[model samples]
Target chain A: MSMYVDMILGGVFHAAVVFLVAAGLQLVFGVQKIVNLACGSFYALGAYFGITAVAGAAAMGLPSVVVLPVLLAAGLAIGLIGLPVERLLRTVYRRDESHQLLLTFGLLLVFQDVMRFLWGPTPLTLDNAYLAYGTAEFAGVRVPTYNLLVIAASIAIAAGLGLFLQRTRTGRIIRATAENREMSEGLGVNSNRVFAAVFTVGCMLGTVGGALVVPASAASLEMSVELVVEAFAVVVIGGLGSMRGAMAGALIVGLIRAVAIMVLPEAEILSIYVVVIAVLILRPAGLFGKAMA
Target chain B: MNLNRRSVLRGIGAAGLSASMPGVFAPAIAQSKPVRIGILAPRSGAMGTVGECGIRAVQWAADRMNKDGGIAGRPVELVFEEETSPKDTIERFRRLVLQEKVDCVQGLISTGVSMGVAPVAEEEQALLIMWDGTTQDGVKEAMPDARYVFRSTDNECEAVMSSLLSVKYFGNKIKRVAGINPDYSYGRNNWEAFRQILTRAGVQYEVVAEQWPKVGTMDLTSHIAALKAAKPDFIFSSMLFADLPVFMKQGSAAGLFEGVNLALPAAGWQLNQLKKSFMPENIVFGHNTLYFALPDASPLQKAFVEDYMERYQQAPHWEADRAYFALAAYKAGTEAAAKATGRWPKLDEIIDAIPRQEVQSLGGPGRFRADKIAEQVFYQGLSTNDNAYDFPTLRTVNAYTADQLQKPPGMDFWEWLKTAKLPV
Candidate 1:
C-alpha cells in the first residue's frame, strides 16, 4: 500500500513537470495555430536562468529564502527572451506548416548550441531552498516538501489558467482570437496583438515549468531534446488545442511510466506509445479534447 | 562524392605511398611534415566537461613532445574533432582517417561512439587508441576483430571487481546491494557483470533493488524512493555526467546516503564538482581514478597533477590524465616499434608494441593485452571531503590488481568467473 502511494505521489510530481511544458505548447497551438517546436528551449532557458539567479543570490550572501523568488524572476526574464523569437515566428506564420517546423527546429538547435557555449556540457545543479525544511512524512513515507510545492504549483497554475480564460477580459479576448482568428479580427480583435500575447504567455509558462523543476532535477544541455520529445507526445495525445487535454495526457503518461518503472522497465516508454496509437485509431481527438466540427 | 576508377586509384595510391614510405617518415620529418594524430570527444553535450579536459590534455602532451623534438624527431601534429553524436561518429571518424589523413586517432568517450568506429579503424588499418570509454565486455568481444583498437582505461569488469570483492569479503553487514544506473547498454552491462560476480562468489547476499533511469533523466524521485524502500546496505551506481552532480544534492537531501554505503564505478569526483553546501557523504568509489583527488602512485603522477593544476587553474579530471597517458603510450609504442623494426613500422607493429610496453598512469604502472584490453593495478576507496578545495574528494583506499578483478588469462570472463575462488 505504501509502495503504491509513493508511486502515485512520484507519478503526480513527474506529471507536473510534463504538464508545465505541454500546457504552454497547447496554449500556443490554440491561439497562434503554430506548434512551437522550440517550446523546449524556453523550458531549458528557464532552467539555466534559475541556475544563474540562485548562484547570484548565494554570491550576494542572501538567505536561502531568497532562492524561490529568484527562480520566479528567472522564469520571467526568460519570458522576455521569447518576445523577439515570437516576432520572428510571426513572420513565418503565413508560410507552410513545414516552414514553421523548419524554423522552430532550427531555433531548437541554435538554442542547444548557445546553451553549450555559455554553460558547457555538464549539468548544473541548484538546490531548492525549501529542502532545508527536510522531508514531510505522508502515507507513512517521507517525501521532499519541495515535491509537494511543485505539485501544488502545477494544480494552481491549471486552475488559475482555467479561471483566467473564463473570467478575465484579456483572457476571453485571447480565447476569442483562438476560436477563429479572421472572425475575431472582423469583430475588431487584433489577431497580431493576440498572438504576441499568447506567444509570450506560452513561453513564460513553459520556462516557469523549467524553473520549478530545477529544484527537483538539475538542468543540462540534453534536457531540451528529452523534454521537448516527451512534451510533443503529450501535446499529440491531448490534441494540440486543448490545455486540459495536456494535463490529462500528462497524468496518464506520467502514472503509466511511474508504474512501469516499478513493475516493467521496458514498458515505461512503450506503453505511452501504445496509448497514443490507440487514441489515433479510436478517438483521434484525445482523452479530453473536443472533436472538430 | 562520386567514386571514379581513376579517383579511387589516386586516393589509394596516396594512402599506400604514405604507408610504404621509406625510413619511417624521417624524410617527411626532415622536410617539415609532422606525425598527425586525431582526437574525438563531445564538445556540445552533457559529456562536454570531459571533452574540454581531453582537448587540453592532448595539446599539453603534444606540445611537450614537440618541445622535446617530437616523435621520431618529426614534430607531432594533433588534430581535434568532435564526437558530436553516435549518429555522425562514422562519418567524423572517416573524415579524420581518409579526408584529413591523420596517422592516428584517440579520445573516444562514449562507448557507443567508440564501438561504432572500431570496425572502421580495423578496416582502414589505422592506429586507433581508445583513451577513456569503459564498456569492457563489449570492447573485449570487439578485440578479436578490432585489431587496431587499444584502451588505456580499465573495462567494466576490471574497474568494479576490486571494490565489489572488498565489500563482499572484507566488510561487515553488507549483505544487501542495490544499484541505480543510467538505462543504456553501458550501465546494464556493468550491472550484469557485477551481479554475476556477486552471485557466483556465493555470498549470503541479495540484490534488494535496481533502477535504470533514462540516460538524461534529471528526476530520480521514483528511482530513489524505490531504492530507499529496498533498504540495501550499499547503493551502486553507473550514473555519469550530469546525473552525478544532481545525485549528490538530491540524494543527500532525501537522506539517501545517511547510513547506506554509496558506490560508483567511475565519475566519483563528480562530487568534487559540487559546492561544499551540497555534497554527498561517505561514497566508496570503485577506482582511485577521477584525477582531481587521486593517490600519488608515482613521481610522474604527482608531477602531472601539480602541472595540470598550475596550467589549467583547476583540478584536472581523470580524463586529462588518461588523455596524457594515451599519447604517452602511443609515443612509447612508436619508439619501441621503431627500435625493433628499424623503421616507423606498420600499424600491426605499433599495435603489438603498445601492449608489450608498460604505460605509467595516475593509478600506477599498467600494461595492455594483445587483445588491447588493460591489465593494471587499481585502487578503490571511500570518499571524504578534506575541505582542501571547495568540494569533497577521495582520501583513503584499498589496492587490488587487474589480475585479481579481471577475467583469468586466455579464458573468457564469464567462463572464468564460474570457477574462480572468492578472493578471501
Candidate 2:
C-alpha cells in the first residue's frame, strides 16, 4: 500500500518537472517551426542559476520557505538568455531543418563548456532549500512537501498557460502567428516580436523546471545532455508541437518509469523508449497531437 | 644541387619534419633530454573535477622530481589528453605514444577505460601506470599476463573494508540490507564484493531491495521511496559522482536516512559537496585510500595537505593520492632500472624494477605485488561534525590492510572470496 502511494507521488512529481520542459519545447516548435535542441541547455542554465540564487537569498537572510519563489524568479531572470539565443537563431529560421539542428547542437556543446567555466566541474546542489518545505505523510508513506508544492505549481502553470493561449489578446496574436506566420504578418502582426516572446517563454518553462528540480537533484554539466534525452522522449510521446501533448506525454513517461523501476529496475530507461516506439507505431501523430493536413 | 622548385620544397619538408618530430630524429641524443609522460584524464565531464585533482597531483610530482634533479636526471615533461570514451581514448593513446613519443603513460580512473587501454599498452609496448582502474575481477580476467600495464590496488579492498567497517559499527543492529548503486561495472563490483564479504563473515541479513540507476541518474526519489518502503536496516551504495550528492539530498529529504544505516564506500570523493544537515549519524564512508586529516603524524602527508590546500584552496582526496602513487612508482622504478643498467632503462627494465621497489605515499608505504597491483590500505570511517573544518570529517577511522581483502595472485576474485576469512 505504501509502495503504491510512493509510486503515484514519485511519478506525479517527476511528471511535473518533465511537463514544464516539454511545454517549452512544444511552444518553441509550434511558433518558430524550429526544434530548439538547446532547450536542455536552458534547463541546465536555470539549475545552475537557481543554486546561485538560493545562495544569494540565504545570505540575505531570506526564510527557507521562500526558496521556491526565489528559484522561480531566478529561472525567469535567466530565461532572458533566450532573447539573445532566439536572435542568433533568427539567421537559420529560413534554413533547412538540418541546419537548425546542427546550430542548436553546437549551442548545446558551447553552453556545456561555458557552464563548466562559470560553475566549475563539480556538481552543485541546493542543500538547505530541499528540505525547507519538509515532508508530508500519506497513508503510512512519507513524501516531501516540496514535491507536492511543485506538483501544484506545475498544474497552476499549465492552467495559466492554457488560459492565456486560449483567451488573451496577445495570446491569440501569438497563436495566429503560429498558425500562419505570413498571414499574421499581412494582418500587421509583428511575427518577429511574437517569435521572440514565444521562444523566451518556452525557454523560461525549461529554466523554471530546471530551477525547481535542482533542489531535489543537482546541476552538473551532464544534466543538460541528460535532460535533452528525457525532454525529447516527452515531446515525441506527447506530440511534437502540442502543449496538451507535452503534459500527457510527461505524465505517461513519468508513471511508466516509476512502475518500471518498481518491477524491472534494469529496464527503467528502456521502458520509456519501448513506449515511445509503441506510440510512434500506434499513433504516429502522438496522443494529443493534431493530424497533419 | 640546383635550386629548383622541387628541391626547395623537399628541403623545406625535411626541415619541418626534423623540427616537429624531434623524437623521431634524435633517438641517440644522450642526457639533458626531457622524460615526457603522457597523461589521460577526463577533463570536460562528470569526472572532470576528480581528474583535475589527479592532474594537479601529477604536476606536483613532476615539479618535486625536477627540483630533486628530475626523473633519471631528465626534466619531466607531461603531455595531456582528455580521456573520453574508450574508442576516443585509444586514438589519443596512439597519438601520445606515436606522435608525441612519451616515455610513460598514466592516469585512467574508469574501470572500463583501463580494460580497454591495458591491451593497447601491451601492443604499443608503452609503460602504463593506471592511477585508478578499480575493477579487480574484470581487469585481472581480461589481462592476467599483462607486462606493460600496472594498476592501483584492486577496488575490492575498499568494498571488503567498507563491509567490515559497517559490520563493526552497525553489525548487531543490521538485519535487512539494501543497495542503490550506479548501473555500471564499478558499482556492480563494489556491491558484489561488499555483499560477498558481509555474507561470508556470517553476518546474517535479508536482502530487501536493490536499485541500479544509470550512471548519471540525477533523480533518485523513486529509489529512495522503494528503499524506505522496504524498510532496510542498512543500505549500501556505490554512487560516487553527482549522483551521490543528489541521493543524499533526496534521501535525507524523504527522512529515509534517519532509520537506515548507510554504507557509502566512495562518499569521501564528494566530502566537500556533502552537507552536514543532510548527513546521517550512523553512516560509514570510505575514502578508497585517502583521509583528508591523515590522522597520524606523517611528514609526507602533512606537507601534501598543506601544499595542496595552499595551492588549490581545497583538500586533496583519493584521486590526488592515487596520482602521487603512480608517479612515485614510476620515478622509483625508472631510477632503480637506471641504477641497475648504468643507463636510461627500457620499458621491460622499468617493469622488472617496479615490483621490487617500495614507494612512500600519503597513505603510507606502498609497493606492487608480483601480479603488478599496488598494495594499498583502504580507509572507512564514521562522519563527524565535531571537526573545525567546514565540511564533515571522518571519525572512528579504521584501516583495512590490502592483503586481507585482495585475492591471491593467479586466483579468481569470486572463487577466492568463498573461502576467504576476514577478522571479525
Candidate 3:
C-alpha cells in the first residue's frame, strides 16, 4: 500500500510538470492555430534560466527558502522570450503546417545552441536548493517537500487558467478569435494582440513547468529535445487543443510511466508510446479531444 | 605541344592515375601528405560536453605531436564530424574516410555508433580507433576478426572492478540491491556484469527494484520513489553525462541515497559536474580507467592534466584520457611500423603494429591486446570533500589491474566471472 502511494505521488509530481507543457501546447494550438513545438524550448529555457536566477539570488544573500518563488519569477520572466519568438512564429501562422513545423523545429534547434552558449554544454542544477524545504515522509516513503508545493502550484495554475479562459471577457474574445479570426477582427478585436498574449501565456506555462522541474532534474541541452517527445505524447493522447484533455493525458502518461517502471522496468518509455498508439488506433481523437471536422 | 582534346584528356588521366598510386611515389607522398585522422564525436547533444572534452584533448594531442616532430615525421591533421545517431554517424564515417581521405578515424563515445561504424570501418578498410566504446559482447559479436578497429577498455572491466570494490568494502552490510541504469546496451551490460560478479562472489542479496530509463531521460522521480520504497541496501547505476547529475540531485533530495550504498561505475566521466554538496560521501564512483586525482601521478598524467586545464579551462576526465590513449596508440603504432619497415607504414602495416603496442596513458602503463583492446587500470573510490582539490576528490581509492578486471582473451565475460578470482 505504501509502495502504491509512493508511486502515485511520484506520478502526480511528473503529471504536474507535463500538464503545464501540454497546456501550453494545447493553448497555442487552440487559439493561434500553430503547433508550437518550441514549447519544449521554452521549458528548457525556464529551467536553465531558473538555475541562473536562483544562483544570482543566492549570490545576493537571499535565503534558500525563497528558491521556489525566485524560480517562478524567473520562469515567468524568461517566458517573455515567447513574445519575440511568437513574432517569428507569426510568419508561419498563415502558412502551411509544414512551414510552422519547420520554423518551430528550427527554433528548437536554435534554442538548444543558444542555451548551450549561455549555460555551456554541461547540465546545470542548483546545489542545495532542492532540499531546502526538506523531505516529507508518508507511508514510510520520503518525498521532497518541494514536489508537493509544485503539484499544488500546478493545480492552482490549471484552475486559474481554466477560470480565466471560461469566465473572463478577454477569454470570450480570445475564444471568438479562435473560432473565426477574420470575424473576430471585423468585430474590433485585435487578433494580433490576442495571439501575442495567448502565445506568451502558453510559453509561460511551459517555462514554468521547466523551472519547476529543474529543482528535481538538471537542465541540459537535450532537455528541450527530450521534453518535446513526452509533451507531444501528452498532447496526442489528450486530444489536440483541449485543456482538459491535456490534464487527463498528462496524468495517464505520467501514471502509466510510473507503473511501467515499477512493473516491467524495460518498458518505461515503450509503455508510454504503447498507450499513445492505442489511443491513436481506438480513439482517433484523444481521451477528451474534440472530434475533428 | 599539340593541344588536342584527346591529348589533354590522356595527360589528365595519367596524372590522376599516378596521384592515386601511393606505392609508385611512396617517400614523396609520405613526406608531403599530412597524416589525417578523422574525429567523430557528439558536439551538440547530451554527450556534447564530454565529447567536446575528447575533441580538445585530441586537438591538443595533435599539436603536441607536431611539436615533438610529428607522427613519423608527417604533420597531423584532424577532420571532425558529429557522432549523432548510428545512421547519420555511419554516413559521416563514410564521408570522413572516402571523401576526406583520412589515414585513420578516431573518437566514438557511443557503443551503438561504434557498432554501426565497425562494419563500415572494416568495409572501408579505414583504421578506426574507438575512444569510449565499452560493450564487450557487441564488439565480440560484431567485429570478430576485426583488423582495422581498436577500442577503449570494455564496460565489463569497470563493472567488475566496481563490484569488487563494493563487495570488498561493504559486502557484509549489503543484502538487497537495486539498479537504475539507462535502457541501453551499455547500461544493461554494466548491470549484468555487476550482478554476475556479486553472485559469483557468493554475496547473498536480492534485487529489490530495477529501473531502466532511456539515455536522455530528464526525470527519475518515479524511479527514485520506487527504489526508495523497495528499500535496497545497495543501488548500482551506469548513468552518465547529464543523467548522472540529474539523478544525484533528485535522489539526494528524496533521501534515496541516505542509507543506500550507491555504485556508479561509469560516472568518472562526470567527476567535474558531480560536486561535493549533492554527491554523497560514502558512494563508490568508478572512473573507468582514468582517476584524475591519483595519489602518485605519473609525469604524463601530470602534464596532460595541467596542459588540459590550461587549454580547455577545466580538469581532464576519462574522455580526455580516452582521446589521449587513442592518439598515443596511433603515434606509437605508426612510429614503430615506420621504424621497422624503414619508411612510412602502409595502412595494413599500421594496423598490424597497433595490436600489442604499449603506450603510457594518463591512467598508467597500458598495452593493447592482440584483439586491439587496450588493457588499463580501473579505479574506484569514495567521494571526499575534505580533499586538496576544489571539487570532490576520491578517498580510499582502489586500483584494479587489467588481469583482475578484464575477461580472458578467448573466454566469455560471464564464464570468466564464474571462475576468475577477483580481488574481493
Candidate 4:
C-alpha cells in the first residue's frame, strides 16, 4: 500500500515536469499555429544554463538557496533568446507553415551541435540541493521535498497563467489572436507583436521546465529530440493550444506511464504511444480542442 | 569567336595522342585513387554521440595504421557514411559497397543497425567489421553465408552474465535486485540475462519493480522512484549515455544509494567522463573488463596506456583499446594467412586462418571464436584510488576467463532463458 502511494506521488512529480513542458508547447502552438520544435532546444539550453549556474555558484562560495533563483534567471535569459528568434520567425509569417516547421527543425539541429561544441559529448549533473534539506510524508509515504516543490511550482505556474489569461487585457489579446489571427489583426491588435510576446512566454515556460528538472537529471546533447517529441505528443493530445488541456494531457501520460511500469512492465515502452493513439482515435482535435470548420 | 583550322587540328591530334598513350595516364589515375575504408553509423539521431566515439576510434586507428607504412605499402583512406535513420541504413550500405568501392567497412553502435547492415554486406560480399553492436540472434541469423560479418564487442548475453557474476561476488550482502534499463533489445536482453543468471545461482530476486523508459529518455525521476520503492539491496542498470547520468544524479540526490549496491555494466566507461560532475565516493561503481586501465602493473599495459595518453591527451576508453586490439587481430590473422598461402590472401582466407591466431593486446592476449566474436578475457573491478596514478583506477577483484564468462556454443538461448523464475 505504501509502495502504491509512493508510485502515485512519483507519477504526480513526473506529471509536473511534463506539464511544464507541454503547457509552453500548447501555448505557442495554440496562439501562433506554429509547432515550435525549438522548444526542446530551449529546454535543453535552460537545463545546461541551470547546471552551469549552480556549479558556478558553488565554486564562487554562494549559498545553495540562491540556486533556484539563479536557475529561474537562466530560464528568463533563454526566454530573451526567443525574442530575436521570434522576430526572425515573424519575417516568414506570410510563408507556408511548413517553412516555420523546417526552420525550427533546423534550429533544433543547430542548437544541439552548438551545445555539443560548447560542452563536449559528456553528461553533466547538478548536485542535489532539494533532497539535502527537505523531506515530507504524505499518505504514509516519504517523498522528496523537491518532488513536492515541483508539483507546487507547476500548479502555481498553471494557475497564475490561467488567471492572467482570463483577466488581463494582454492575455485576452493573445487568446483572441489564438481564436482567429485574421480577426485579431482586423481589430488592430498588432498581431505580429502579439505573436512575439506569446512566443517569448512560451519559450520562458519551456526554459523553466528545463530548469526545474535539472537538479534531478543532467543536461546532455541528446535531450532535445526526446523532450520535443514527448512535448508534441502531450500538446496534441491535450488540445493543440489549451493550457488546461496540456496539464490534463501531461497528467494522463504521466499516470499511464507510472501505472504501466507497475502493472505491465513489458508494455511500458508502448504505453505513451498507446494512449496517444487511443486519444487520437476517440477525439481528433484532442480532449479540449474544437474541430476546425 | 575566332577559330583556326591549324589550331583545331592540333587539339584533335593532342587528344588522339594522349588517348593512345596508356602509360602516361597511369600516374594520373594511380595518384587520384586510394584504398578506402567505409564508416557507417548513426550521427544525428538517438545513438549519435555513442556512434561518434566509434567513428572517432576507427579514424584514429586508420590514421595510426597509415603512419606505420600503410597496409601492403599503399596509403589507406577513410570514407564516412552517416546513417541518420534506421530506414536509410540498408540503402546507404548498398551505396558504400556499390559506388564507394571501399576495401573494408566498420562502425555500428546499435543492434538494429547491425541487423540492418548484415544482409547488405552479405549480398555485396563485403568484409563488415562491427565495433559495438550486440544482438544474440545475429550469429545464428548470419550463419553459413554471412562469413564476412565479424563482431569485436561482447554480446548482450555475455554482458548480462558478467553483471550477474559481479552480483555473485557481492554475495548474501545483496538482498534484492532491481533493473532500470531502456525498453529496447539491449535493455531487454540485459534484464533477461541478469534474471536468468540470478535464478540459476539460487539467489533470491523479487523484481520489486522494473522501469523501462523509452530509448533516449532525458528525465528518469519516475524510474528512479520506482527503483527506490522496490528498496532493493542492489540495482543492475542498463541505461546508457544521457539517461545513465540522469539516473545516477537523481538516485544520488534521493539518497537511493545510501544502503544500496549498484552495478552498472554500461557505465564503467562513463565514470571518467562524469568524474568532474559527481563524487566517486557517493556512489558504488562496478563494470565488466575495466579494460587496459585496470591496475595490472604489466609492462605492455603500462606502455599502451602511457602511449595512448601521450598521443590523445586523454585516457583511453574500452572502445580505443578494443579498436587497437581488432587491428592487431587483423595484423596477426593476415600474417598467418600469408605464411600459409605464401601470398596476400583475401578476407575469407584471412578470417579462416584466425581460429587460433594469437596477438598480444593492451588487455593481455585474445583470439577469435567460432562465432567470429573475439574471445577477450575480462575482469570485474571496483573503483579505487591509486597513489601510483594521478587519477582513480579500477582495482581488479575477480578475473573470469573467456570460457567461464561466455555461454558455450550450440546451447539454446531460450533454454538458458527458462531459468528466470522469480523467488516468490
What is the iRMS for every candidate structure?
A: 4.0, 6.0, 6.4, 6.7
Q: How accurate locally is residue B126 in candidate 3, as Cα lDDT from 0 to 100?
A: 88
| lDDT by candidate, in order shown | 0.72, 0.83, 0.82, 0.66
Question: Clashing pairs in model 3?
Answer: none
Model 1: which residue pairs collide? B291-B318
Error of 4 at A111 (Å): 4.4
Q: How would the candidate models be sorted by TM-score, starting from the highest?
A: 2, 3, 1, 4
Residues A245-273 of candidate 2 have per-residue lDDT tens digits of: 99999999889998888777888999999
TM-score for each predicted model, relative to the true structure: 0.90, 0.93, 0.91, 0.82
What is the C-alpha lDDT profile of model 3 across B1-424, one tens digit per residue?
1111011111111212223424322453347457788888877667878888888788777766665556776767778777888898899889888988888999999887788888888888888999987335542444546788897776677777888888887886879999988887777878988887787777999989888888877788888878888899899998986888878878887788888888888787777777676788767888877787787989878887888777666667888878888988998888888878888888888888887588887788777788787788778887678875545678788888887887767677667777887788
How accurate locally is residue B215 in candidate 2, as Cα lDDT from 0 to 100? 77
> Residue by residue across A90-188, what tens digits does model 1's lDDT show?
889999999999999999888877876676566776644537446788887677777887888889988988899889999999999988888999999
Give the clashing residue pairs of candidate 4, or none. none
Report the C-alpha displacement of residue B31, candidate 4, in angstroms. Answer: 13
What digit string (tens of lDDT, one per residue) describes model 3 on residues A192-219? Answer: 8999999999999999999998887788
Worst 10 residues of 1 chain A by lDDT: A125-134
How do all the candidates rank in terms of DockQ, highest first? 1, 2, 3, 4
Cα miss at B263, model 3 (Å)? 1.5
